[model samples]
Target: MNKIISALCFSIVALSVVAQNNPSINQADTARQQRETDQVLREVGPGDSVPSLFSEEDADIGPQTVLRKKKPTWFRGTADAQIFYTDNMFFQDGNEQEAGLAVTTVEAALTTPPCITRFASYRAEVGYRHQFFNYFGSDDVLAVPGTILTRRFDAEDFDFDSSTAFAEIVAQTKHYQFRAGFDYTRLLGFEPLR
Candidate 1:
């Protein structure tokens, strides 16, 4: 009698579990959830938009942002050499000395890409230049020193080389333009005059 009672209890519990997990019960809930999702998508429409903190007109108040698709920077250089004759080596009106000389000039620069915007355009550059003067027949002539008629010097005292370093910024607009720059030059062979 105890065995029969236990078998009956087990069968009742198994049937109750099967009824709770039936497919028909889940089908109705799935259909209701799918309908709600479709209704939400229809109400939102097909277009997409992003929310922004500021309006379009408010963005134009301060300095405008410069936009460049491609920034191109370049390194540039130039060299020049010339041989010339000068009748006045010292550039004196009373007594002019004649000489033959060669001049060589070299320049190099590095420039940043131009920054352009709706209101203005600007660029920055740094450069260096060197010039050398060689006097061939200058030694044959005599140079008069400053304020001393008795003192005479060789023409080689005027032969000198110079080096210059510079930096510049250029800016332009529709109605106005501006430029700012500075250059420093050093003479290599002018100590005798000092």
Candidate 2:
């Protein structure tokens, strides 16, 4: 009985030592695992060729071409004329006094692009207006104290002319704007002066 028990223990110890010394079993197990993984991959089929998320082809997707608008010119101007006629002039108290009036106006302006370093813009403008009145009548005399009142039949005294010139500089930013300018006006043959 002792010999049998001792032989059994010896065999168990030898088997464990052999298992540790021999690496073939480990290699076989690894090989079997690799084969199983390959078989599973083959069954799954080639995964749909996933395109790169940041590929260069995607750069051309939006707004293939840009459209540009034309810019306007810097100078502009306008001119106009008007005519008026009446058989009975108001000053003649509804009498047969033919009257005619003509008016003309002209305006012009100029603007420049903003400067690079200071971001300032410049503008200049000028305007002119003229009025001519004609009346077919005789002169009238009035009685007054310490003053001579003489009214001419022709509308020469009623005609007027005006002109204006202006220049300005402006500085602007995203939030605010600053402007400075100078203007001059002239008038001839107005009622007060006449």
Candidate 3:
């Protein structure tokens, strides 16, 4: 149960990280595409450069979504890593007589894109962990029927994945551009607040 929860939390963190990592890449792609396509027109009419400031819909505030140009695309990359140490090898949870085992971790990551319009990316990472636990620790705090007591624990460690997949889409007009996409996340898990 803890592992499952941990995984879910890790995924949430990773998602947020990816979202923040890329801001105008999509917009840049859209803007570049627009500049390329709009260049064909020699004359720039007032209407061309400036579309309707407000929605043209007869209804008031009707879907006030406006379009705008995007910036030029530039190459993007990242490098991340971590290191860890622990006394528990299994990292199980149960009873804790002492302060529990201690652990440290170190990890890293690196990713790159294939093209601007084409949403493609890959990442890699690796880390180490070590810990020490005792019998009172929950990792071995099992309740045996006959013995009516728990067992002592030993070593433990942490687990982390070092890979990711990402995608993005960009749309634009004269004044605004919108972007949406998904990407792989790592140990940085997610948990929505109530």
Candidate 4:
């Protein structure tokens, strides 16, 4: 019957769509775990040395607490003491002039939550970043390259400030994770930020 054939076609198409989407749901969470496993495998099996940054015996785990922390991990520090400067490089536009821009960003995190078995745990992270730019362009043009103008000023406005901040809560188990966060961004448009 034609109705049966039509139903079969629709079912095939629906199955195909679901099959395509299911892999991506698992891909993102599994990616980090797979990389960690590969790093461990390479270090132990091939004599490839990967430095263990933290001592294993120092992990803090409570016997009576809800979490069973067999392995505790923690790291927090920053190592950078340098200045950066950049001049006009040129992307594309009629606006042309020398420029100066500087960017400085700092972030840190501490994840020491105990585990609720081999399958579940809670984690949180917080970070912030900021950037600034000062681009001065010329709108004055002379009839000749060396010709002088009585008074010159550019009639252009430029974007000169940007910043972003983020905080995330990550609760995860063996096969899945739930994440919630607040993200604030100030990285758009040429309007002056006050």
Question: Which one wins on lDDT?
Answer: 1
Better of 2 and 3 by lDDT: 2
Alpha carbon lDDT at 71, candidate 4: 49
Those runs of model 4 whose alpha carbons end farther than 4 Å from true positions after fitting are 1-92, 96-100, 108-122, 134-159, 170-180, 187-194
- Which is the better candidate, 1 or 4, if ranked by lDDT? 1
Better of 2 and 4 by TM-score: 2
Q: What is the TM-score of each candidate against the true structure?
A: 0.49, 0.35, 0.22, 0.31
* Residue pairs clashing, model 4: none
Clashes of each: 0, 0, 42, 0
The alpha-carbon lDDT assigned to residue 11 of candidate 3 equals: 100
**Which residue runs of candidate 2 sit more than 4 Å off their true CA positions?**
1-64, 80-104, 114-146, 153-156, 171-178, 188-194
CA lDDT, every prediction? 0.74, 0.56, 0.42, 0.54
Looking at model 2, which ten-residue stretch has the lowest summed lDDT?
136-145
> Predictions ranked by TM-score, top down?
1, 2, 4, 3
Mind sharing the TM-score for model 1?
A: 0.49
Displacement of the residue 112 alpha carbon in candidate 3, Å: 12
Give, for candidate 1, the lowest lDDT window spanning 10 residues: 44-53
Q: Write the per-residue lDDT of candidate 3 for residues 13-93, one digit (tens) a residue.
A: 999999877868778877886766444332343334432334564355444322443433344443433334334334445
Give residue 19's error in model 2 in angstroms: 76
* Model 1 lDDT tens row, 30-85: 77766565445434423432222246734556333323323375787899999989
- List model 4 lDDT by residue over 35-146, tens digit each: 6755564345333444343455235431222123234556443433333333332433543344443344444556555444445677777766555444443355221233
